[model samples]
Target: MKPTGGSVGGFLAAVTPARRQRDAETLTALLQDVSGREPVLWGTIVGFGSCHYRYPTGTEGDMPLLAFAPRKTASTIYLESTAEYADDLARLGPHTTGVGCLYIKDLEQVDLEVLRDILTRSLAWSEAGGSEQAELTVTG
Candidate 1:
């Protein structure tokens, strides 16, 4: 995905389901704090930093190094190499995963500290050029 130069405030303000909106705000702040990067809108996703990923099939694109979206069902947290986070995920509280996506239905149900650690590690991984890693695993 590409950054749309969209206003993060406008996007968050337009979020439906007041609860989701509130959670999005909290997440936005948390991500920004942890990432130390300004939030950018990649389509509907609020993302921080950027990484260029080339899949095995050579389908490549640029995406946020850390990002999330507030959806009707849950908040989707994007991270790289989720397979490497098994232990961390176990301590993350109620959540589900799909490849690189971490789905959190309720942020309050999880330990914010653990979430912060996970995001921190994930950011470090991306900064260390994880997208160019020889092997990319996302078995979650």
Candidate 2:
């Protein structure tokens, strides 16, 4: 739930499948640029910026404003609910979505610009205290 202060390069370099490594690197640069914050490793996730919130049940913790993890099958980018950006995701190419997750099968297969816009908008939403931030997981 905290910065851990781990080496971003160490984690990215260790990612399997060269393609995922490239994608992770690309995402790191984009998120850092969009958030104007250095990337930090929260276990397997590379995250930018930071925020703290408490749920109604009082389970409070901090999480990255934006984050992504290079998975064995796809790149998992964590963000606010896709319901808020249904239009954008439609243009993002072949991908899947979870409660607060965007899964890209191949970074190269998706539109980088669209992905960038999503990251930018997601960061803004988090900074503005997005409605569901309190439910945002700190586990990644």
Candidate 3:
């Protein structure tokens, strides 16, 4: 499927104007303080980082060091494998999750400290090879 946001604007453009403006401003400030760089476009996702991923099937791709997307239904944060961090999620405020996804009503509802910790861990995990990420998505 085509990415919601076009090339120049990136996925941020796909979100509603108000939400987009809010997320954009938040992301800009966050990245500046944390990652120290601006977000990049990953199709419809807003990503940060210089990391990449390679699969056992031989498919290889690059993604931001960290990334999140604001979709029509809900916002998605691609932190890391929920499988490896199940216990962390349990203590991470109120969140409903999936095999590889974390569903949150909005950024405010979740714990920012825990979220930042996860984001930091996810970057380290991604840099460490991301084998866990692939495993987290595999279903028997």
Candidate 4:
């Protein structure tokens, strides 16, 4: 999927209730700081920067360098690949993994430093074109 021209604030305001707004804002700031880019709303996700990828099937597209969604149940963090960061994930506090996403109930439930480390690693991987090397894994 490709990004749409939506406003980040509008999307956050729409999806996040007041209870979760602070966490969403915190994530936005952290992602922006780690990525060194501004945020863009891609559908319901808040994405920072972008990366281009071409698949083996001769398909290619641009995707967020980093992105996340503040869902009602949890905050979904879009990592480039969770498989490459087992050590980090092991110490990432309370969280779950699904393929490329890291799910946390809220910012308070996880360690921010660990989260930042993960984001930093993900950004580096994306920048280095390591997406194709990613192996999916599921863990909690």
Cα lDDT listed for each candidate: 0.85, 0.85, 0.59, 0.78
Clashes of 4: 0
Which candidate has the highest TM-score of all?
2
For each candidate in turn, give its C-alpha RMSD to the true structure in angstroms.
Answer: 4.3, 3.0, 5.7, 5.3
Q: Estimate, for each residue in 1-140, the C-alpha lDDT of model 1 and write its tens digit.
A: 78999999999999878878888999999999998888999899999877776666777677788899999889999887578789999999999999888999888899989999999999877776665543333211
Off by over 4 Å in 1: 55-57, 131-140
lDDT of 4 at 41: 81
Predicted candidate 3 versus true structure: per-residue lDDT over 1-140, tens digit per residue: 12223452544555674664465556545644566555666576666655545566767555566666666555566665677677677767766677666665566666767766776777666656667325222110
- Arranged by lDDT with the best first, the candidates are 1, 2, 4, 3
lDDT of 4 by residue, 67-140 (tens): 99888878889976678789988988888889888888768877899889989988877777664543222110
Weakest ten-residue segment in model 3 by summed lDDT: 131-140
- The per-candidate count of clashes, in order, stands at 0, 0, 2, 0
How high is each candidate's TM-score? Answer: 0.88, 0.91, 0.72, 0.86
Global local distance difference test of model 2: 0.85
Rank list by TM-score = 2, 1, 4, 3
The 10-residue segment with the lowest total lDDT in model 2: 131-140
Off by over 4 Å in 2: 132-140
| Residue 40 lDDT, candidate 4, scale 0-100 | 84
**Candidate 4 at residue 32, lDDT?**
95
Native-to-model Cα distance after best TM-score fit, residue 36 in candidate 3, in Å: 2.9
Model 1 TM-score relative to the real fold: 0.88
